[model samples]
Target: MSFKNYAFYDKIMLSKPVTVKGLTFISVVGITIQAYGKYGVFLWSTITPKALIVVDSSGDISFYQISNDTATSELLESITLLFAEE
Candidate 1:
């Protein structure tokens, strides 16, 4: 028996997460999203610049922005989200 034989030593811990697909999201107001899956809709936020993204059955995607609590479609390639303070 040795220290290197410990069960915890068998696995390597990652300093950060690794994501090959979907998107990582975070925002102010204590919201943190690790991953967004494929298909269906992505409910962004209810605050300023409220946004929504819908993915159809065939993989067609759409982006929408909210104004006066109404959602309006927009053309977007990608979007960025803020991270919480460490």
Candidate 2:
């Protein structure tokens, strides 16, 4: 589960469950109070040697690589801030 890029969010259609650290999550339309609802909004993310961990506003976490080729400039900036070396 190595990542080619870091983590961020964009609107993507997921047809199956994405597993991260043994946790599984499915995509949902709109926001919901449920714990596993919504996988589109990326609130925070971190990179590790094995995976890129992403957490949404709903507290749902997923592991996957973010596609840099399709990422927006704004999202790229945010991701830069998150991973910037101090």
Worst 10 residues of 1 by lDDT: 5-14
Residue-level lDDT tens digits of model 2 in 1-86: 33233333433233345766755654322111212214333244322222244556567765554454333444445445645643
What does candidate 1 score on TM?
Answer: 0.26
Off by over 4 Å in 2: 1-12, 18-22, 25-63, 72-86
- lDDT at 30 for candidate 2? 16
Best TM-score among the predictions, by candidate number: 1
TM-score of each: 0.26, 0.22
Q: Give me the runs in candidate 1 sitting further than 4 Å from their true place.
A: 1-49, 68-86
Alpha-carbon deviation at 86 in model 2, angstroms? 43
State the lDDT of candidate 1 residue by residue for 2-83, as single tens digits: 1221121111111232223553222212122232334443433222334444555455655445334332311121222112
